[model samples]
Target: MFTIAVDFDGTIAYHDWGKTPQFVPGALETLTLWNQQPNIQLVLNTMRSGKYLEEAIWFLETHGIKFVGYNQNPTQQKWTSSPKVYANLYIDDASLGCPVTKPDIFTPGGRPYVDWAKVDQLVSEMVLFVEPIHQD
Candidate 1:
């Protein structure tokens, strides 16, 4: 089985910085197709919180996305939401911060960084589906 952690904002939706969010072209359709597969699970990872997050959930549900979980804080316990499904891909558009790695730049303290580019690349290459094994 393949689990995917897809970011809601810029990744599947067009994020205009301070402007209202918009779904990227083909995002919902792509998601709908992905959901039909038995082994693919789509999870939402975003920064939105509280009521805003609920609103997002409603939106997804309305669009026929029935199997999705939101992790507002990707680095915390929320990661436990879907512990059984090990994610092979995580898609987001921050270009700076990603949960899988250190921040891209040092905080005045000078530590390693999270390279969002690397995360994007890794997710892009992940295989979302595999052929089922057939018994002889």
Candidate 2:
């Protein structure tokens, strides 16, 4: 299975503190599609903690985005005690080379956010490259 770590704020939703912000356009659809893939396991990776983290979890659940792990991969603890979450891929607004939309009215604090359309396209291309080859 391939593990994918995804950030919450700024990546999935607008970067707003103390309150849940609107989901980035196409974020739900893209994540939902990934969640349905049998070979893909998603983990929520973010800086949020305490009640804030709970809120994010609630938001995802309410939106029907089911994930396998949170912050740390449950399967990783068996092999190592590292604090960092391990994944074949990571989707975060802060990640370099990640497509992001320019600051707009929807963005909080005037900060740019993830561009889901570009992200989806890029991920689709990556999947095509890694898909298993079949022979007759």
Candidate 3:
């Protein structure tokens, strides 16, 4: 099983985060599907703190997303946070110059703001095609 570290602001929801963050279309559905899978776990890894993270959790729950965990505090230099064992994957839009270095990280853009369906489709397609590189 693997924990998917998904960003809250831009990945799960749109970049325009507010008191009530609007989820990107299909994001909830994707998370819900991932949650039901026995070999996959969803983790809310975001910069949001305190009540904000709680609110995000509530929102996810409202949309029937049962995540394995949430991380409001991430290591400063290291992008990931302190958590228990095992491998993980991250889904975020702020990954600057990613796929260029790690070509599998960046996904193809769909129809800008109105095409998360295509974006999600592209991500799944990329994941299927990209060979997993083991890190020791």
By TM-score, the best candidate is 2
Lowest lDDT 10-residue stretch of candidate 2: 127-136
- Give each prediction's root-mean-square deviation over alpha carbons: 10.2, 5.0, 9.2
Instruction: Kindly list the per-residue Cα lDDT of model 1 for residues 1-136, writing each as its tens digit.
Output: 6667776665655444444445554467567766877877777777777877777787788878855557632333554764433455666555445533332342222223233344434444455353222112
Q: What is the TM-score of each candidate against the true structure?
A: 0.58, 0.89, 0.63
What local lDDT does model 1 show for residue 102?
33
Q: Which stretches of candidate 2 lie over 4 Å from their true place?
A: 129-136
Model 2, 1-136: lDDT tens digits are 8888999988999877666567987799888888777878899999989888888898899999988888989999999999999998899999999999998774575678888888877777677633222112
lDDT of 3: 0.58
State the displacement of the C-alpha of residue 128, model 2, in Å, after optimal TM-score superposition: 3.0
Clashes of 2: 0
Give stretches of model 3 more than 4 Å off. 72-87, 97-119, 122-136
